[model samples]
Target: MGRTLVQKLWDAHTVADLGDDATLLYMDRVFLHERTGSVSLKGLESAGRKVRNPEQVFCTMDHIVDTLPGRGDDTIMPSGKDFITTTRAAANAAGITLFDIGDDRQGIVHVVSAEQGITLPGLTQVCPDSHTCTLGALGALAWGIGSTEGEHALATKTLAVNKPKSMRISFDGELGFGVTAKDMILHLIGAYTAAGGVGHAIEFAGSAIRSLPQENRFTVCNMAVEFAAFTGLIPPDDTTIEYVHGRPYAPTGKTWDAAVDYWRTLQADDDATYDKDISIDCADIVPTVTWGNSPGHTVQIDGAVPDPSNAPDANTQTSWARALEYMDLKPGMPIEGVPIDAAFIGSCTNSRIADLREVVKVVKGRRVAEGVKAIVVPGSSQVKLAAEAEGIDKALVEAGFEWRESGCSMCFYAGGESFGDQERVISSTNRNFENRQGPRTRTHLASPTSVAASALAGKIADVRKLG
Candidate 1:
């Protein structure tokens, strides 16, 4: 019997069989952010236990740090400075690597980990954030944990987790122009609903997925949470090896050769079986947008908002009605022309350098529409530097987009920063639940290009139609 990649990684990391599906798994790395990282660090300190492997832990400020270029520890979130200060003091005292505000390595936890080679294939990584699975794009078995679980991992270097069922989503065929990984995932969620992959860890495969650039795979895996999957993965390939090579923390010399050889063997066998299997043809997917609150409440860019009366069940009908009301959208209305008051182009989901480059392409010679407030935030300081070097930041700023520092800004209204109530926004960030960006803030999530185009048009515009 051939084994799936999940089983291979699982068996290798299993430290003990606790029975009842729970196994004590060795953890290779743990990344933290200011918002929840402080909670775990503070808890560990209160318990008088030191991190078993401080070197394996890394911390950065993201969730609450101000993304303004000249910003300091102060933030839009009330008492946000405390999170930054506490996390810094705790991290330094514990000897863990801290990417302080001015550090070049400072960025979102997931982005820094990948760009620095801290996350590698076949390793187990966890963080106190849901989007931790973004690292799984590099073939690592990574997922999010609550602050308590994070504390346990920090102290013991292991976590007792119930193995999840395995599922495979195969993307066959070539992607069309202007159709991105963001659209592909949105289309899948729309077809399968948000809860489709519940209790499963997804392995994204097939030619279309392999065709994506390494970092773009992060964009695809970033939305795995929207599929309700435990995590998302893509086995390391030649491109993966090349991307990992020369990264700051990547193995060197003999270690590098050995690691690459091992990563090459991390794929699922040809005859491997999975609990569920789904096939999506890339040709069938187009630029998509979410008209409702959930990622699943999506339609083609050219399509109309769904009428709740056509829903398959009463619950679904109710959900549809509520989403439409909150979104201020009318049934049968075209999604393309929906008015937007703000546009945000940053988040763990789609804020990489490649994403920024795409944004520049769409809005380079244009200005933001009058009355629209648009901002471009890089995913990390390193990305910000790279984009600046390429003049991407200049183009964005000149085109009327606010070029801000890197952080998870405006992705959600976690702290004091928000788009205010009842404002409609087209964003590159994930999720559009009611009040996610602000109280009553209506969010339509899309690709950077789409966000850029929508910012120019002051509506939910499609990138395909941009001149």
Candidate 2:
């Protein structure tokens, strides 16, 4: 019996077996953002503890930072400036790399980590943010941690973790037109339920996954946490190698060659076995959108809202009822043509340059529907610059979209900025939980192209139906 890819990664990073299913694993990279990172860093300083390896730690201004143009330390979120300034002081005192508000590298932690080559195949990475799992797309073992865990990793460079059972989800067949990685994930969570992957480390595989561009792979793994999985990964291949080859922090020269050789061997063996296995036919997936508060409450773009009575269980039925009431929607209502007040495209999940290009394809010559407010914030300053160089920003702005600076803007309501109360919004950000975008804001999660189409229609429009 061969071991799964997760087993290989765990074994390689194991510093010691701490017994009772816990292992002390050495963390190669630890990333932090202002929100929770300030707590961890401040705690470490108060305890008179020093970072074990300052060079391996990285911090950035992201969560709660204002994404408006010409912004600085001042933020609309109450005391958001304090979080930013405190994190900056701590990072500087700790001698760790910091990507400040104006730095080109400044972006969401997950995006910055991969773009800079700070995350690598076979490395164990941790961040004090749920979306940290986004970096797992590179074949790394990455997951979220609480601030306490962040402090521990920063001080000891290791964490005692319970190994999760391994699961393999193979997506076969080819994705249809207008379908995307975002839809693929939404469809999975919709079909399997949100808690399906609990206690498991999922490996996304099969022909469809292999065929995805590296950026698309990131989109898939980005939502594994949303699926309730401990983490998710895709085995590194030629596409992975090509993407990481010239990254700033990636190995160079002979070191690059050695790293590639090791990465090539990181795949699971042919006979490898997993604790659980599932197979999905890409043909069954469509451009999906969430209709209720939870991501699992999803339907096809043209599907009707399901009645609570049809829910699989009593708890689900109750959940659906609550979601429908909060959303001001009714059972049997068609999901499409549901009017929306705003559209947002920016988050750790779907704010990369590739995501922007897709949005541009749909908005190039079309104008946003009258009375619909739309905005597109790049994931990072680098992505912003790249989009500007190619006029992607201009196209969006010309189409009635507000082109804004980089950062996790309007992804969640942090009391700083958000959509209007009771406003219905189609967004590219992950998680559509209640009050996620604002007080009484109803969010619909979709792919960037789908979001563009919705913005144009001023409703929940299907990308496939767009002319």
Candidate 3:
């Protein structure tokens, strides 16, 4: 009956019940970026309204900024650049702190908030990007909101919505080599399908999730959207506190201990309830990659693509066929040795220091294969600084990977640049939906190490083989 972290945070943030199943929840922090925030700002302007609490909101320029730094060209998506400029001006006018380009602290919103300690355990966080759930690694109830809803949060600090049911995904045992959190979640996605967790807030439990580092856990939580989960989380514990301590905005000295005590008090009671639960043995997971459109269309690198003839129903058959057609993949084809045109190692999902270090360890002495375009981008400016300080950036660049600036580059086609149409990219970013990287680009989602290995071999390979 132990109360889960989600319940405790929800209860603490609840302002009032709105209606049947709906609650007016007070958000602790709101993050804004380009694209969505500008539209929301225009909506606010159209409404002739002002933000209710500017101090609680933070803005950054991540989505539209040029990730290949020193470009000096500044040719960004038209709407994107406007959004950044407008959001920054509005934030400044409203007294909201803004992290614009050249802020030193500037980076992807998720990475910026995390590195700055603006996001902490037992807090309610929201952004206009689905991957905002990446903050849940700190034991927060973080999720994404629509532009209009984001505007409302900025002005009112509250959002009205029905409570999501809770689903617990328990993972046990240690993961084997090349098997990572991405594999564990991908396997879960394959088991549950894309919409499996619809209307549920998933709480990832068990030793496997708990034992993994923060970056990997963030990677797992980042893909909660692909499973149709509203948000995903792991409870804050010693690991959470250790990661937050001494961070830029984190509580310091005596205030730090007080905050820790308060965070502990937010744990769920022993008799808390969940709408559903599932378990997975981590030892069975392996280096994984997606062969089709949806994240569920994945398997062990050593496995072959599924033959849709195995589909239990016609709906599955249609799904399989559509996925295969979009991916230009044949049923039952071997997933390994599939040629790749590009390899990317970045995004909020797997662009942290740990991920870079892991990939560098795999490709330290190896050069990228001929005919492969590979690049490495850190998640945050601070992450870039940390990697370079440790010489990981040099190692990756020496191996022929482009070491670029920090941002959500190639995670999606936000910067007006993208992989060529019909090109195949082995990427560390989440989501393999059609055109996620470009209008007609193909994406193969995998872990940082797998991406590095694929870049070196110019094909999908089990990263563990390289080590």
The best candidate by lDDT is 2
TM-score per candidate: 0.99, 0.99, 0.97
Q: Give the lDDT of residue 46 in candidate 2.
A: 99
Weakest lDDT window of 10 consecutive positions for candidate 2: 406-415
Candidate 3's displacement at residue 409, Å, is: 1.4
Give one digit per residue, the lDDT tens place, for model 1 in 1-467: 99999899999999999999999999999999989989999999999999988999999988989888798988777798999999999999889999899999998889899999999988999999999989999999999989999999999999999999999999999988789989988999999999998899999999999989998999889989988999999999987889899999999999999998899999999999999999999999989989999999999999999999999999889999999999988999999988899999999999999999888989988999999999988999999999999999999989999998888988985346899779999988879889999889999989888889999999999799885
Arranged by TM-score with the best first, the candidates are 2, 1, 3
Candidate 1 stretches greater than 4 Å from native: none
Candidate 2 residue-wise lDDT at 36? 94
Q: List the pairs of residues colliding in candidate 2.
A: none
In candidate 3 the C-alpha lDDT for residue 300 amounts to: 87
Q: List the residue pairs that clash in candidate 3.
A: 1-270, 1-271, 2-270, 3-268, 3-269
Candidate 3 positional error at 445, Å: 0.5
Arranged by lDDT with the best first, the candidates are 2, 1, 3
